[model samples]
Target: MRGRFGVHGGQYVPETLMSELGQLAEAYEHYRGDPGFTTELDSLLAEYAGRPSRLWFAANLTADLGGAKVYLKREDLNHTGSHKINNVLGQCLLAKRLGKTRVIAETGAGQHGVATATAAALLGLECEIFMGLEDTERQALNVYRMELLGATVHPVTSGTQTLKDAVNETMREWTRRVADTHYVLGSVMGPHPFPTMVRDFQSVIGREARAQILEAEGELPAAVLACVGGGSNAIGIFHPFLADEGVALIGCEAAGRGIDTYETAATIATGSLGVFHGMKSYFCQDDHGQIAPVYSISAGLDYPGIGPEHAYLHDTGRATYVPVTDAEAVDAFEYLARTEGVIAAIESAHAIAHARKLVPTLDAADSVIICLSGRGDKDVAAIARYRGHTVKED
Candidate 1:
């Protein structure tokens, strides 16, 4: 019950993993409050991962929209070029404290894998990354980046050969060797402690954004928006704002083609309640209860399920989840580049696409904060292909 977010999260893992989970939970509880651990993690965040990422006012975009003032929480500027580094550093440090010699993780677009590899290298831990074969092909640059940081990349070909399959393979690997290894789950989607833990690590985004927005505007923004794959970035920025009744939490889910088509990965829009990947959450599943294949132009947003905490937030009306089609996201991706001279990740463009829609409805005096979750360098080639441009790689 401690892990359950209104019955959406639990230890749905195998019995063999129960004890390891217990040990991890205990260690995390102790280290989370331990001053030494906190100091080291804070140092890593500030000096290594570049914490306190800038919150920039998008004046050009705001004027173009002719509605609410727009602000971008620039997590894209962090080291390794994504918000994934926040959770990765924390988990890898915890693994070190637990005396684990190795760390393994599952990644989709490979941001998490790259970040995990980075942390493992910094902390002197052996690292392995399980990624979908489809994603490996889509994000080959990131695979090379991970390898450069000393991580072995395993491409999973099971299931739909996507994020879900990567998670499955990583979990299987963990079960086979739990004694000297730690599973650095990439998102807030796993069993107990993980969703809560990852949220805590990533909440730095919301905390800093809240302070910066108030200092700049003298008030909270009308809404905070972030793209939701497994919902780490959304929950990170949404958690601190949960108590502010005036602030709205919005999660933009990937609607690959459209929610009407089977190719969509908009879990909140098209999925039903189900248990998968060690958590009970909203998943894209067929009528027979089998997980359905999901698609998104952004490899990062290709997951078929929303995190349990997000499901809770949706059920309680504390947050609103909406679908952004690939066409719309790509448009936003390019629009941001032209308008703001900022190349946002395709994953983050989903949120930008939603913000383009929502900001138009709000008063000019109102403001909205969009979490620019990652830099777009890794996606430029794929995005070019999506736009019918032939990209020749060296």
Candidate 2:
């Protein structure tokens, strides 16, 4: 638990990054031992980030899905309206405790950027977010949100102008300014302590899911599901349920078209082992072992690699990973919006897509929990454009 979870994690960065990770690891360990860190984080979650987000029974949706009970862990209801805040606050506070004056992060779809910006604003930490140029164009509202919250946004114009490029840019910046800056990676992926540390910070979802489900049903669920992008949201909700024999953890990867040939970011479903952005994990790579271009209707799921812990979980069969196609996710997104009046993030819709299939297979008495990772407002335009239409506000 102290080091890499097998080969999936380590300080595999350039020699220049060794001392940087070492400094961060030492500071993080020191903060972990400090009660003040715990107290501050706890108080923030209670008063600000909305700890213990509700687990609501989606009876209508379950009934529509052939009568198997389904519950939603409403992480979408959090302060910045996503599960990202939980990790952001923790890392930003840790950065402060480490005497870092500024915090920086790399983001794909801008959920992490908004969350990091919110944390920076709350703690008065100077913050910068690196976003792929394409994503900045698509998710302009999030860019505006970050700027409004006092965080500077840099567009990553390198390497196809996508998430991978953003990550590379952020790491380069971190390496150049490691003295008084901390890189708060926005996922359960990345090198060394980041994967482990982010998971610990995000364990609140699983912790809440377990208690809420038991309180509602007097027993744990048959399965728990979350969409795996960089895998933080999924791991956050799956880790606390790993030992339960009756409970299965399902991580849904994005199959933008299908996993077999093209247009997918199904890292564990179809990816091979490779190194990208400092960590060796399952990644979508071509025949030459070069990182392949990824596509997804959901900006958040359009990444080539998943988190290291997810790689381990997939291999051990402790968690099952299935690819959910963009078409399938879109269908589910519309279904949930129409049925429950809850418009879901397309990243979140991947989990809901799985639930649509999972519920029907379960007995009427069986129940499943889905992590509602974030709200859908940021996705409305993307979803509309993908559908070749506009979504009229309700």
Candidate 3:
């Protein structure tokens, strides 16, 4: 399997897990390029996960912004309300192909957890999800959703109670059950096969969007943007456009309060190169090189380390990664809801926020497409609280 995205991705897991990883890598490499596997995945994507998500022209938003034409690659409309289902379906199917009986994953905001649960249910595989205790509390709706899908949810209470901790716990669980279990890693981070596998699964976004945009606008857009949360959705949408030098690949990172403050998840904006989570990548860490506590208004972005591909992209300056503050993301979330009747996940809003800033600087003929990664229904309560409102539940 292709690893080391320009010196960033590699299998750095514990020695005990190397064999498991090697087996997975071999299976993935074979299945990924096989026509039978491709046919099955394509059919499942169309019938179950809703393939070919829309490329909607956000007319009102573009007009309001008073600059470039704006289009939204609507992954938000996918089944399970996020682009996460794409990878989950592929991984679960691979697990079945590998004769694995169970699948497990770690989630931060619960999108991945919900998607994993949905895939496992559809595939008739036992599923377990590890979510940080803090995430479980913040995303209780998703926790219940997972249980409803017949997956067990384990709340991890260690290490800032966030995405990183959930990953640590999931790796531990995988180590214990390697023979019968496949860990459905949620992002383009982690070891070699996972980053490559997840990215290939997600590349459908960019592939479709590229052709759709060209058909609609008669040319490639000036830029394609997506919010980075362990960089799955971003990588999914970015990988296809990598060779098109005319199209800029932009990733928006969460600046919880601001990059100036310690409470931020702007990994590329302020992180240093380090190793964690079985990959060599940039991470938000302290002077002593310990992973630092990270914060983001969007739970999905609250992780210390980013996907290794993102690290490589940053290093090569092939992609531009910038910080989008919580205030900006929140404002964009509300703005899209009011102006375009679109309620986007706070994580997705980070990209929209950056788009707001970027679009105004471009000509009207220029176009920008943002990967709307998920619906905001999951973040409604949190948004209300952020705006100092309370929703009374019946």
lDDT of each: 0.95, 0.90, 0.94
lDDT of 1: 0.95
Which digits, one per residue and each the tens of the lDDT, describe model 3 over residues 67-122? 99999999999999999999999999999999999999999999999999999999
Q: Model 2, which residues run further than 4 Å from truth? A: 391-394
Best by lDDT: 1
TM-score of 1: 0.99
For model 1, residues 187-282, the per-residue Cα lDDT tens digits are 999888899999999999999999999999999999999999999999999999999989999999999999999999999999999999999999
TM-score of 3: 0.99
Least accurate stretch of 10 residues (summed lDDT) in model 2? 1-10
Candidate 1 segments whose C-alpha is farther than 4 A from its true place: none
Task: Give the Å shift of residue 273 in candidate 2.
Answer: 0.8
lDDT per residue, candidate 2, 284-326, as tens digits?
A: 9999998999888878889999998899888788999999999
| Ten residues in sequence with the least summed lDDT for candidate 1 | 1-10
Range of the 10 consecutive residues with the lowest summed lDDT in candidate 3 = 1-10
lDDT of 3: 0.94
Q: What is the clash tally of candidate 3?
A: 0
* Each model's total of backbone clashes: 0, 0, 0
